[model samples]
Target: HNRAGKGLGVQLFHSIEALKTYVEGPTFEEPVDGITLIQEYILSPESYITRCEFVGGNFVYAVKVDTSEGFELCPADVCQIGDLF
Candidate 1:
């Protein structure tokens, strides 16, 4: 799911019995390749984009994905493609 600013990834398992039954025995590493719940924290897309910037000419452009529609400095149609970095 797209959690926006929340840097979390979640996976749900049915039950503990199902997990144990699939694994048979608990070990550091499973031999038979059992289904085990796993979770990892990842950086949010907004955060990822904020860390990256595009530098061209004399301007430093940051990823402003949530900027207001009325905040445009130049018109899309009139702006030259090559001038947009």
Candidate 2:
């Protein structure tokens, strides 16, 4: 789900029970074939995330992602995602 963008497989759980239910339920699915990673969510004052692209330790480019639209950040038309962000 790398290019799917907008935190496609990301989920936030406030409690252990909720997380368990999700993991046990059928709704919990991942397109990727690998381990499911659990991590803490950092609260952001702004409704966006910045991604800096680099190649071989050299800077390539950077973009400010607008998360107000629920994390679907791929701007490419091939993704058929949404409005440009």
Candidate 3:
């Protein structure tokens, strides 16, 4: 929470109205002002995501995020298990 802001708060939505409400509703302060990201949600088995880190063309480490708790992917108290293409 302290390192990467509030992380991804309340990412999953069941309906369009819910998503709209969250988009328009109040939220915690972002680490950067006016910086928010929205994306198409996809369903996946186990609700987990894998992240790979690379440094200087070398693989460093990998993390498999568990989204059952929430979308915050950080190692701190809070995280987001997002997919990028």
Candidate 4:
């Protein structure tokens, strides 16, 4: 998922240049004080993240966000979603 266009949505980067392009657009120049980080990355077979919240010790709300198309999941009333979208 760290391909050319997936960086902006998920922070996934194929290389330093790709990350820079996402930050500064197509024509990107290296910054003098830019920060770089290396961390453990795990690949998940499931292409989605489920967020759940509870209230009063009871089940409240849950949502499943698809990761195949992109990473940022917009809340209801502001975006469109579905298996066919």
TM-score of each: 0.19, 0.69, 0.52, 0.41
lDDT of 1 by residue, 1-85 (tens): 2232222222333776755664565533432335333444343544222323445654465543432222122323444345565
Alpha-carbon lDDT of model 2:
0.71
What tens-digit string does per-residue lDDT give for candidate 2 at 1-85?
A: 4433445667779999999999899997765655577778787999888888788999998888777766566644575634563
Question: Whole-model lDDT for model 1 versus the true structure?
Answer: 0.38
Which lDDT tens digits does candidate 3 get at residues 26-52?
A: 864453456556568787877778877
Model 2 TM-score, all chains together:
0.69
User: How far is 45's C-alpha from truth in model 4 (Å)?
Assistant: 0.4
Q: Model 4 over residues 1-85: C-alpha lDDT tens digits?
A: 2332223324567787766667678644343345333444567799876777688999999987776666555545546646654
Rate residue 55 of model 4 by lDDT. Answer: 81
| Rank list by TM-score | 2, 3, 4, 1
Model 1 residue 60 lDDT? 61
Cα displacement (angstroms), candidate 4, residue 51, comes to 1.8
Tell me, by lDDT, which candidate is best: 2
**What are the per-model C-alpha RMSD values against the true structure?**
15.1, 3.6, 7.8, 8.2
Show model 1 residue runs off by greater than 4 Å. Answer: 1-12, 25-37, 40-85
Ranking by lDDT: 2, 3, 4, 1
Tell me, by TM-score, which candidate is best. 2
